[model samples]
Target: MSEVTTPAMRARPKRYLYIAVLIGLLSFLAYGATYPSMQAEAAPGTQASLEVDVDLTEWELNPSQFDFQQGDTVLFNITNSGRFSHNLEVSNTAQHLNSPTIGAGETTTLEVTLDNSGTYTIICAIPGHSDLGMTGELTVSGDNPAPAEGEFLGIPAMRLSPRNNTAVVGSSQEVRVTLHDFTLNADSIEGANVGGEGHWALFLDDELIASLGEPSYTLEGLSAGPHVIRAELRNNDGSAVEPALSSEATIQVPAAAP
Candidate 1:
């Protein structure tokens, strides 16, 4: 009688082990409730006290123009204070070169969050000076994010290679900015719209530099003559709603080498 166990072979292996443990517990509780973690003593850079005085041999643009309003999480305490060598970048689209680098009295901070309204830019990709302008612009959202004829979210047109467009102010310039066509409805990329995509800014001439997620760069201790760089394609609440393809370039820094 010790051989009487048959309910269809124990309910078919307990119904295939309860459907493989309920599909691995709903894929580990949906990846632990959607990605979240950032605390290694927090503050990676971005606290804002306002002090952007980047002068790559007098290109001139102190307080050029920056407004920030949608939802502002502000903080751009970059300090290259001048003496050559510089970096800074922030982006939403124009293909990904999201900027960030500071050297020459070095100090960094750029925890931006803007929330979107429309109008975005920030330059310095290095190559021939962002096409000869070194760029700037960021406005975000608000261009009728919908309520009548829907469809809003665009800033994907990044395609640069040939050594990240070009830049040779002092030396070492291999910069890269690659990302493209990031269509969106908005949820993060500038909040509201509940989908995605937006952010761009890289300037080293006027010195904002890069926030690049991937565009490529190596720029090192600059100090030569004549410089300019640019990149702007934003919309993640920092704005620059595409200035008819906003961009700039102009390079000539090669000097320091005695």
Candidate 2:
């Protein structure tokens, strides 16, 4: 003889099954709340491979300004169109990239990987070439945060003392300059092109007389006549500041006592 199974006994097993399922679900929810998901993080900025054409001529580089994102690989197709041998050099404090010298009517390629973001000096490596204006600028932007207030981002303003139409009573004169939104980084002179930090180039009668890392300089051996003095902001690599921030003053130096 077999014993009959009660309805309550059967319902007890169903309740136990439901309770086990509920407990498992609650445990899963708790674990999810405590730990973060194991998903892959996104990359910062997107990198790009680019090709650019550059024309080299006497004391000039066509397309003098360049813009690019950081971590870019740029292949420069350089052609010498002038009647001289020229080579290209791109440099900053962090890296230096150069190309072989190519003669007129010749062509070459330079591959550069811009890892850092800032300003880089682009110039012809030949002697006296950059002085004659065979220079350009390469600007690399990154995903870095923006600069705070009091940080320079554009061209600076300059003013020279001894305002125009002033007279001095000697063969030497002291000129003082005032600058705004700029810093003179004497340590990095001729090193690399950094943003917002550089020295000043002093020009007397349209000729470069000195590169000043300070604000005041004295002029000696001056002729007894009117002279024009100009102060121009320059980059660390000796390149002219963009938009050309400069101040000019004309003064008369009287003859010395005889």
Candidate 3:
């Protein structure tokens, strides 16, 4: 028993010290990586409504334009102190459009985010919208804000031109859109087979006019009025379904210019 040497007495103390040090290091890194973004994430969704006056003729906006890091959360407030039957739209330069009715005198807040690290365009879709200074953009970079998910829903991106928000009906208008690529595994998006592609259907708020399942598609012979176009997708199972990534485009198809 003399060889026992009581080595356990020395080893136990050192092991306990090492464990304590390791835990401290991990805790520090965890906090450091998440703190900044958690602070930047503006309250859950878009901002709340605002009170505006009806007598004013001009308006002001909090952020005419914005740029954010991947994990950053942006907060936006809309102020419309102008006299007109108008609203504000937000989008990226890549053609994401939004149109909110401010109704001569109203104010509100909205939000958009980039879960992907890329450049984007935001615009107001009211007729003659962007041209009337109703548009702005938000550029994002680095690791984006993804939806706590690890899957793709087979949905592709949709876009129109800067001047596409307003068009003249019964006129030869250029209808263009682009669909990007996405990857899906484990079939979490429904009827998803595997190695299937994505496509889009253009509508005039009533009828289906074109099917753009490729990179880009255009619709001709369009009549004028207020029109809203949507791009939906089909899964690997060849089912007409709404992908998690559907986008809507609005244009004022003015009563065929007389």
Candidate 4:
């Protein structure tokens, strides 16, 4: 016996087919929206955009620390969300890509390549900006090249201790400097290097404060605020080294009582 065909049966099959197609289309749309972000996170050197957000008033940076791989080309978009203009610079390393001074609420794009692999300090070079805590760090993954013999003018090295930027208000910030392959001598011994004898100059906010034969100095008479301390290896005649071998640290003094 032949079975009778019903319109309802045909309509139900169509309904299920339509529902399956709808779900497939929705899944494709969702994947398309999320795929780019996933790809960026998984691939370190992929073509992507990295953002650095800065707030001068609060002296804070978003994503204050980031990781980079050697040979990676990244587009950095630095945004100044504060009320003042600011610029960013990388210090204590040979890698040299920077953003210009960006005005308040303005954004700047900087394309940079990570050629060297090492820990780098990121700071705003606006004199007192770094003192207010506008700083961060970048950790790059790869091998950093070493200088060959005679490639350097002198055996020059420096270090700053108590590197963190916190200190008591109205008190002297004591900084210690360590030198390697370089000598600290008195003014009587300043000028050309004889037996590697030289001296060091202490700078506060880029201003030369004192020339010392010893490595320790007290930063005194500073108001309660952030300050940048720098130590430069100099020739006996008070001449700066070629390209300047130096080390720096930032200290923040707590506000004193009224």
Candidate 5:
């Protein structure tokens, strides 16, 4: 037997369907509100952008040399691992860029576009820093580029003991150096470049005799007569300090008895 059509029964089924649709719509809206849209990632074996890691330390930059392709965008991740403050500067004839000073144990980022092919100088803008070997080079493949000019720093105050015209009875003489705004690091000598820290170069009669790590040095094998002793501050790599800080002392030695 065929069932008779009833509008109320059919209408009830439609109402249930409507309620299900409404619940589904509400659930969709709630999920959308709770979560953010996902972003597309780069395909495998591909990168969205080129990145380079740079390390800054006592008077040096890790990966001191690197290269990039022309017209490519690069992101430099710079980290300061040294105790002193440092900054990075990238300059070429086509572009010049600088990063803010990064204190010890800090990190920063620099983004740049290499539209032109050439060599870029990377250095620490802090005075006397680059001179101490806090520098690097970036080569953008293509054409030759002009070399960047170097920066200079002022000299520190220095004083030498063993006053001029002082008489010495023995062949050995004691020399002392008093430096201001600088430190003597004998352990770091010939190790790595470090700012505001290095050893002193001792000169006798304008000749290099010794590299002194301590403040005082005893000179031996001195002949009887007027002799000149000089001391100059130098970097850990034995490079001459900027502005050439030095002090001299003249002393007289008596002749040996016959």
Candidate 6:
């Protein structure tokens, strides 16, 4: 018996063809989605590179100068070509970067981002290393300008003893900040004369921690890291002086022995 050709029968085969095509497109899309990621994994992009070879015999660093663009990702490759061990420290008032101590025939890498454009000082953190001439310079060019000196009220001036970016962590640090053109009087701080200082406010990492009449203080309980100590001159009324005469120092703290 011969079957009759119906319009519905013809439509059924066309529906199956559409469904098959749809699935093929879905599979192609899934495969295409992973292509870029696979390509990226195969070949990564390169930024800027800096290579430094250190020798303790001469107490000198090769390629004493490095330059880069601000906001660029830079890879610092350091190799201790000398027999003695050495570490690297790059720091400024706002940030600090360091390399672990690498022994002779050892190489290390430090990835850094120069967030701002300025001159950065590099030195060996090992005791007496920097004095022996293990130092270098880094210059980053960018649109941002270097920080200007903070304005002061009257003749206010503050100088931190031992300076900033010089302290070691896990050790007792004695900080003496001398303030000129103002007298420190904590008792009568409230409503004190403008030029005559009351008590000084101490800030660590921008957090107010102490208000003391003396120009000296002891730093403790600091974890292993870099810290910024700031001192501000206040009026007798305990209010911050106008234009804010302040001084800040960055201190590096090392990890304590376990």
Instruction: Give all TM-scores, in the order shown.
Output: 0.28, 0.41, 0.44, 0.42, 0.40, 0.42
| Better candidate by lDDT, 1 or 4 | 4
C-alpha lDDT (0 to 100) for residue 88 of candidate 5: 78
Best by lDDT: 2
Candidate 5 ranges beyond 4 A from true positions:
1-155
Choose the strongest candidate by TM-score: 3
Supply the global lDDT for candidate 1.
0.51
Ranking by TM-score: 3, 4, 6, 2, 5, 1
Give lDDT tens digits, candidate 1, residues 1-258.
578887898899889999999999999988776645423244654433333343332232244457665555656655555554445455543223433443457665656665455555565544344444556665543432211112233433554432222336346555454545443222345554222355556776778875443445566766666556666656666566544334555555666667
Task: Provide C-alpha RMSD values for all models, in order.
Answer: 20.2, 16.5, 13.9, 12.4, 18.0, 10.9
- Candidates sorted by lDDT, descending order? 2, 5, 6, 4, 3, 1
Q: Residue 249 of model 2: what lDDT?
A: 71
lDDT of each: 0.51, 0.81, 0.52, 0.69, 0.79, 0.71
Q: Mind giving the per-residue lDDT tens digits that candidate 2 earns over 127-233?
A: 56889999999998886432443556564766565555456656887877766678888788897888778999988899999888898898889998899988888
lDDT, residue 220, model 5:
91
Please estimate how well model 3 matches the true structure, expressed as its whole-model Cα lDDT.
0.52
lDDT of 6 by residue, 1-258 (tens): 999999999899999999999999999999999988888663343444544454433487776788887766766778887777676777644446676667788888767777778887788766567799899888988886444334343456555543546656366566677655567886776664756567788888899988888878887778888888888878777787776777776777888888
Model 1: residue 166 alpha-carbon error in angstroms = 9.1
Tens-digit lDDT track for model 4 on 1-258?
999889998799899999999999999999999999887675644544454444433475665687877666666667888887676666443443456666678887767666677776777655467788888887878886433323444556666643544343466877677665666778544556664567888888889898988888887878777888888877788887665787776777777777
TM-score of 2: 0.41
